[model samples]
Target chain A: SQKIEQNSEALNIQEGKTATLTCNYTNYSPAYLQWYRQDPGRGPVFLLLIRENEKEKRKERLKVTFDTTLKQSLFHITASQPADSATYLCALGHRDDKIIFGKGTRLHILP
Target chain B: DTAVSQTPKYLVTQMGNDKSIKCEQNLGHDTMYWYKQDSKKFLKIMFSYNNKELIINETVPNRFSPKSPDKAHLNLHINSLELGDSAVYFCASSQDLRAISYEQYFGPGTRLTVT
Candidate 1:
């Protein structure tokens, strides 16, 4: 069975520092991987998508790296702030339009 | 204006009662999905509809049914809901899953509480 794993433990980082979250998968070769941010009492919002051929993608202060060889993707938030605190999800997209999601990693930015 | 919206943000009902959650998307997308987030906060896909046709149906119980009257609307109906059905249900939409861009927009989510 295919599985997607994100850090189950919450990540706590100081404000102004960079936070790096990881997503690892097995038994699947997804064409692309997507990241989403979910706040308390709210649904997840799309963040970024990185392709199998792409090494890295950036948007504002957010960065995503996909390493198909390792079947892992890394999401980074630079100069993180309290407002950036949320649970981030990673999803793997198959060619058949199937999207499987990880449990998500909760990041807390402490002041 | 909200791109994706769900009705009855909070639903409280007794076990064995039937309920329904409605979803609508105004982004003119061809795909809509239903996802359930459990108490442990694990999100999983339940059903997906494309162009008002059922495309992806996960390993959900037969007690749950999804209806898409139009491409922009997908509604979830739960029959004889159980205590295990207590969770948050989210509706999402995307232009097309197989399109060049596959970003999904999510609704505010409807929290279902079965006591």
Candidate 2:
């Protein structure tokens, strides 16, 4: 069966530290891998997307690395702050508009 | 203005009842989708529509139906709702179906509770 896994159900980090999240998939060849941030009682908001051909993508303080060979993706947040705390989701998409999302990793930045 | 919106932020009903959730996007996108998020916050795509036509349907029960009146609107109708059907349903839209870089914009989501 096809599966998408975000390695950690929850992650905690001290303020100003970097928080890294992992997403791994099996049995799916997606052209693009995407990340989203969802807060409590709100729908997910698009963060960044990395193509299978691209090894990494960065936007401001956020960076995403895609390793198709290993079937995994890493999401990193630099200088993490309390305001950046939220559940982050990793999604896989093919060319035909099909998208599958993982369970998401809840991130907490303590003061 | 909100780019994507969903009606009835919260719905509470008993089992065997019928209900519907409506979604609309003003981003002039060509594709729409329906997703269900369980209590555990696991989101799964249930249906997708492009240009008012169904494109992908996951292993969803026949009791759940998706309707796309146009490219910007997709509505989900549930028949004989059960306790297992309770979840937060989200509606999303993207630029197009063929664009490899397109990212989805999701609505506020509709929380449905089946008693």
Candidate 3:
């Protein structure tokens, strides 16, 4: 079965520092990988999407890198703030209609 | 304006009861989906509909049924809910899943607790 795994433990970072999260998958080759931010009691909000061919994508202070050979994707939040604290999810998608999501990595930016 | 919205933000019911969660999207999207987030916060897709047509149905119990009356609306109804059914259900919509840029917009979610 296809499996997507994000950082299982919560991550704590100092304010204004960079926070890097990891997403690794096995048994599947996804066409695209996406990152989403989900606050408590709220639905996930799309952040970034990177295709298999794309090595890296950036948006403002957020950056995502996809390595199909490594079967891993890295999500980075630079100059993170307290407001940036949330559970970040990694999702994998194929050519089909469905996409699978990871359990998400809880991030806390401490002031 | 809310792009995706769900009715009954929180539902608390007993076992063997039947309940429904309603979802509506005002983004004029063509694809809508239902996902279940369990206690471990693992989000799993249950069903997906494109232009009011069922496209993806995952390995979920037969008690859970999804109904889409139109492209903008998808409702989930669970019959004879069990204790294991307690979780947060989310509704999401995208322009078109078949398209290369398939980023989903999700609703607030409905928390169902089977007591």
Candidate 4:
């Protein structure tokens, strides 16, 4: 079975520091990977999408890198603020349009 | 305007009850999906529809059925909801199912609690 895994423990970082989250998958090769930010009681909001051929993608202060060889993806939030504290999820989509999501990493940015 | 929306954000019902969650997308997307986020925070895909046609159905139970009347609407109907059925249901949409750029736009989830 295909499975996506992220660091289950919460990530705590200083407000001005960078927070990096990792997502790993096994038993599947996805065409693209997506990152989303989810707050409590709210749905996830799409943040970035990087194709398998793309090495890295960035949006404002956020950056995501995909390494197909390692079957892993990294999400980075630079100069993070307390407002950036939320659960971040990484998702992969296959050629057939089926998507699988990671368990997500809860990030806590302390002021 | 809300791109993707689901109705009745909170549902609290007893076991063996039947309920439905309605989803609508105004983004003119061709593909819509239903996902269940369990208590463990594991998000799993339940079903997907493209242009009102069923495209992918994951290993979901037969008690959960998805109905799509049009490209913009996909509804999930769960029969005899069990205590294990308590979870957050999310609806999402994308422009094209086959497109490599499958960045799904998600709606506010419906939290179902079966007691």
TM-score of each: 0.97, 0.97, 0.98, 0.97
Against the true structure, what is model 4's DockQ? 0.75
Regions of model 4 farther than 4 Å from truth: none
The reply for model 2, stretches above 4 Å from the true place, is none
Question: How far is A43's C-alpha from truth in model 3 (Å)?
Answer: 0.1
State which candidate has the highest lDDT: 3
The sequence of per-residue lDDT tens digits that candidate 1 reaches over residues B37-72 is 998888899999989999999999999999999998
User: How displaced is residue A9 in candidate 4, in Å?
Assistant: 2.4
Model 3 agreement with the true structure over B5-56: per-residue lDDT tens digits: 9999999999999999999999999999999999999999999998999999
Predicted complexes: DockQ each: 0.67, 0.74, 0.74, 0.75
Q: How far does residue A97 in candidate 2 sit from its true spot (Å)? A: 5.2
Question: What would the per-residue lDDT of candidate 2 be over residues B1-115, giving only the tens digit for each residue?
Answer: 9999999999999999999999999999998889999999989989989899888899999999999888888999999999999999999998887784698999999999999
* Candidate 1 residue-wise lDDT, A7-101, digit = tens: 66699999999999999999999999999999999999999998888999999999999999889999999999999999999999877767888
**Global fold similarity of model 2 (TM-score):** 0.97
* Candidate 4 chain B, poorest ten consecutive residues by summed lDDT: B97-106
DockQ of 2: 0.74
| Candidate 2: pairs in clash | none
